[model samples]
Target chain A: MNKILTIMWKDVRVLFQDWAAVALIIAGPLVLALGLGLVTGAFSNSDAPTIGRIPVVLVDEDGGQLAAALVDVLTSDDLSDLLAVETLSDADAARARVAAGDASAAVLIPTGFSDSFTPDMATGEMPASVTVTVVGDPGAPVGAAVVRSIVEEFAARADTAVAGVRVGLTQLAGSGAVSPVELPAVGQSMAAAVFADSAAASAASVIRVETRNVTATGESFNILAYFAPAMALLFLMYAVTLGARTLLSERREGTLARMLAAPVSSAQVLGGKVGGIFLGGFIQLAALILLTTLLWQLNWGNPLSVLLLVVAAALAATGWGLLIASLAANAGQITSLGMALTLLFGILSGSFVPLNDAWPVLDWLSRITPNRWAMDGFVALAAGEGGAAVLVPVAALLVMAAVLFAAAALFFRRRQGALLTA
Target chain B: MTTPILIAKDLRKTFGDLEAVKGISFSVLRGEIFSLLGPNGAGKTTTINMLSCLLPPTAGTAEIAGHAIPGDTLGVRRAIGVVPQEIALYDALSARQNLEFWGRLYDMRGQALTQRIDEVLEQVGLADRAKDKVKTFSGGMKRRINIAAGLLHKPQLLFMDEPTVGIDPQSRRRILDMVKELRDGGMTVLYTTHYMEEAEELSDRVGIIDQGRLIALGTQAELTRVVGEQETLRLYLAEEAGAAAAQATVAAGDGAALPADGGLTLFNGLPGVLRASAIDHQIVVNVADAGEALPAVVGRANALGLHVRSVDIEEPNLEAVFLQLTGRGLRD
Candidate 1:
């Protein structure tokens, strides 16, 4: 244990001695968070940095039942506090409003949008698909994403309703309950009722949460609370990578062999390396949180939970670092793979953008990265949620750390002879 | 007789089909500087690694300070100190800090570790630079600290593997002197080097290895006796003369001699000349007596139209012993 600590201390010392690495891994995130916060007007004391009512223009060319349902859902009382809806006649003009940044997004309902949902009896098949397009502003990604989510939900429910009606009509035709000539009319009637029912249910549930949230928090959300942890978690990976790099560098320089030659076991040596990486990451996160609090006056909520989240996040990030080191052939390879993983994880975890609900696939994939879980916990905490809100994210981060550490250990064990040999 | 501090029996290591160490064995007596002398890739470092427990031998057994290799690895490691061929000290750390870390790994702590660090630093002649980062030190200074780290725990045995490599002559001399001091202070060192001169100067007993085999092992006098009553006559020829001699010798086609070795085997059967070989610009001829063989050797070179710039007759040394045993110079 003493030997492990000794090696750990040595590795940490080496990591900090490289001034360039220290600046890159520690100070770089602080600067970026501050800059992003300023740009996003997160520091404005008069107004909270909440994603308030999103401005959206609707161009309903369909003039059909389904299009009217979508317009109703968007302009519903439940979403009134979340989305500021407007009606436009021209599709091109609605898109222009989005492009001009006058609105967060524009929902363009095509001319034959509703006709696609009804089947023709002669063909016994659905009409050619006409898609509804949501043109979003590049500047307000969160607001634009919210508007897009609503449209996507409406489309998904309509598709399900049509499919349900098709199944019902097919069964009715097989049972000789309806004639083939009347099948199309029956399918259209069933589809409209199913679509309206599902749309109302989905809208009531999904749109209700937004209204309740805005009301409960009084539209208060700290943007820095999001960017601060996002930036910190992004660079925490870099810090652990830098630490993991020393495992190979020390071997190349003969220091690893020197350590192994002492009374220390290979387990002790590796344990120290793992501990060192975790410690480096932990210090980087804790220091960033403290610095951002002092410099940016950002509150990270529930000190105990924040500390635990930092530890779990650092542990998971260090596990990734170890996995990269174990797979890489040398210090140079570790650096290349580490940098690539850092950036890839940063983008995937929505460190630069809130993407937790952007796409279902993206949200699921983001679960594999520590940045996502840490960011979620931090964002929740910043929104004035209690410590209980971080429980799931913390648990997920711990599980990620365990699995990655086990995999890295197996790899290290296989290469133990090659690595520890002179 | 002195007790053997380290004993090995048929230690061998094979990397796939390549046999790096081919079942060779020897022992080092307590309180002696036992040098393993060989050329590069000659299994000297491999032997050191195996004994130090860094690598397990494939087909042999060895014990260091009563700790067996492969079984009691922790025990062996605890009893031994390894100064690797590379300057292994952390360049980002100060000399004292690096020593402190290595010392603690050996379970040294508190005042004892601190005082031991100071002692080792002073012994390496870098006490004044203890606080300076290792990167700020010269190549020689780093090498000294590298050795100092190994000496921190004051183990029963120290393995210094080619410690003087790539350093200036003055620094190499200082390290040599430091090794002598350690030996005089009752330290047992297992030193490995490719330099014959270093072995000749440092080893109380020398083991000459080649092609993963221990060709010869004895005291300097004992090993030199392998080339009984032989003297090396070194003939330094001018560049043109050397090249001309090499071409002529190859044209003669005595025994597939390479021109890179100067191919100087013209005086094979000269009176009192036992054998002849070439190294660089000098042709070395092993003879029974320099006085009897010099005239004929020089005359033979002249007959071959080779100009002899100067000549020197050297006493039998480790190089001559290696040449006699393996038919090649230690640097080959």
Candidate 2:
């Protein structure tokens, strides 16, 4: 372990000592983020362009009170500037409209979605839960994203309302204030009151834009929030590439053989190299996040979750670095491959712009990139979601890291003799 | 009679169909500078690599510092330090930092590692520049630090593979002197070089390797004794004169076939001149005695209508021994 740290430390020291590399990895992302922010008019005094009303198709299969309340919220005059709702009977046709770009999203309230919140009169128990599916158009990502966010907010409020109804019924039955036969009616009345309160709160805070302009979406949605992580992750790929290049550079320079010639095992040397790449990428991302936060006053969300995303993202990016190193024959080849992979991943992962999910093939390819998964987590956190929101993205990034690492290790094993020898 | 610190029997290595080390065998006694003298592509680096545990031998067994090669790799690595032909130090790191990293890998730490790093730096005469980045150092200085990194742990055996490969004469001199000092301090050294003069000056025992084979091995006197009482006569020819003559003879279609050795075959039948070969603008002849073979050898060259610019007579040395054994110069 000590030997591995020594090797890792040495590599990191060497990496930082090269000023040109340091500048590219650290300052490059920060400057690009700043430039992107400027170009997007995030810093301009003019009102940020408002998105036109999103065209949505509603398929209400439940026909229950909670489902009606959801429809009312979407079609309300207060949110008229945000959503344009069209009612459809067939769920399949609604989704087809979204897929065909005729609608930004299709909100499908499955049967029993509202009943799942209602307690049975005899058992005082609710039915099994059902979900509301939002099929989003790949062509209009922002509009779809907005519709999705609104639906998510409605579901969260309904959950709170159901919890309130459950607690009120328990209190009423225990106190003997109402007969068991009246429990169902009382539960319904309490649910309506709670839902109305939650619906009002959701309207004022959940999906409303506070100001007329200056920034798109809500007041919390800073353009830097999107571009900052985007640019940082783009260059995080470059940082790991730099670290990976050392694997081949050291061999060509004889330092690798010298290390192998020491009393350390081949595993230890490679472990150190892997650790160095991970640490370099982690530091690059952490540094960029902190710099952007400090300089631009951009909020990146809960610190702990951001740290988790950074670690997982770095691990995934390092796996890519190792993969490139394993495939390349020399340091020069690694450099070229690394740069190409960096830019390619950036473009494919929607680092420059939010990717249009309209293309299924492109969406699937984006899933393979660390940038896409990490950007999902960062954007969620920046939008005021809790740490729980990042669990899926973090897990996906980890699995990507594991698979890529295994592949790189297999390649390294096959070329073991060539790597460690003269 | 010192005990053997390293012993190898039939160590062989093959990459695809090209056999890099072809069943070579030797040993180095403790407290001696054993030199492997061979030109490039003679498998000197391959042999060292196998012994250093960087490469596993394909067929054969070897023991170093009481550890076997194929099995006990860590033990062998712990007991040996390798200085590769290239300057392997990290250019971005300071000399002190680079040494610290290598030292830690050998399990040295804290004050002990610090003191040892200082000692090695001072020994290599780079203590004053220890804090400066290696990129700021001269090529020779970097070479010295490269050697210092290997010496931090002071292993039982140190393998210096052409340590003075590309440096100024003065730097090479300092390194040679330092190597001799290490031997005097009771460290076993396995040095490899292509320069005959370096082997003659440094090795307590020399192993002459060519084309992946150890053709000769012994003390300088013992190896030279292979060509008993022989001397070398170097006849300098004027501006490819001999080659021109050979080409002219071939062009004439004289039906007198020219030998492939560039007219050196003309002196083969001369009395007292046992063998002859050509290297560039000179012809080297091996004979029993320079005093007896000089006049006859020069006369033969002149008789062949080749202009002899000058002549030199050298006593028996590694060069003449290599010529007698392989029919070629060391630099060939």
Q: How well does each candidate superpose onto the true structure, as a TM-score?
A: 0.81, 0.83
lDDT of 2 by residue, A1-422 (tens): 99999998888898889999999988898888878777755677655433456899999998876777788778876567678899999999998998788998999999988778877766767878899988887556556767777788788867876787788888989999989889887887775555445544544443333222212344535767887899999999999999999998889999999999998988999999999999999988998898888887778889999999999999999999999999999988888998998898888887775555445577789888999999999988877778998999999999999999999999998998888777
Task: Give me the displacement of residue B43 in model 2, in angstroms.
Answer: 2.0
Could you tell me the lDDT of residue A60 within candidate 2? 94
Name every residue pair that clashes in candidate 2: A47-A214, A48-A214, A138-A358
Per-residue lDDT for A1-422 in model 1, tens only? Answer: 87778878888888889899899978899889878877876655565456667899999999877777788888987778788999999988998898798998889999889889888757668999999988777566656756775687678777876787889999999999999888988887786665456545545543223334334445444566777888999999999999999889888988888888888888888999999999889988999999988876778889999998999999999999999999999999999999999998988887786553325577688889999999878876765668997999999999999999999989999998888777
Question: What do the candidate models score in CA lDDT, each in turn?
Answer: 0.84, 0.85
Instruction: Please name the candidate that would achieve the greatest DockQ relative to the true structure.
Output: 2
Residue B235 of model 2: what lDDT? 83
lDDT, model 1, position A56 = 97
Predicted candidate 1 versus true structure: per-residue lDDT over B276-310, tens digit per residue: 76656777788899999999999988777677899
Candidate 2 lDDT (Cα, 0 to 1) = 0.85
How many angstroms is residue A314 displaced in model 2 relative to the true structure, after the best TM-score fit?
A: 1.0
Candidate 1 deviant stretches above 4 angstroms: A37-101, A105-138, A142-222, A353-363, B236-248, B251-255, B258-264, B280-282, B295-310
User: For model 2, what is the alpha-carbon lDDT of residue A331?
Assistant: 88
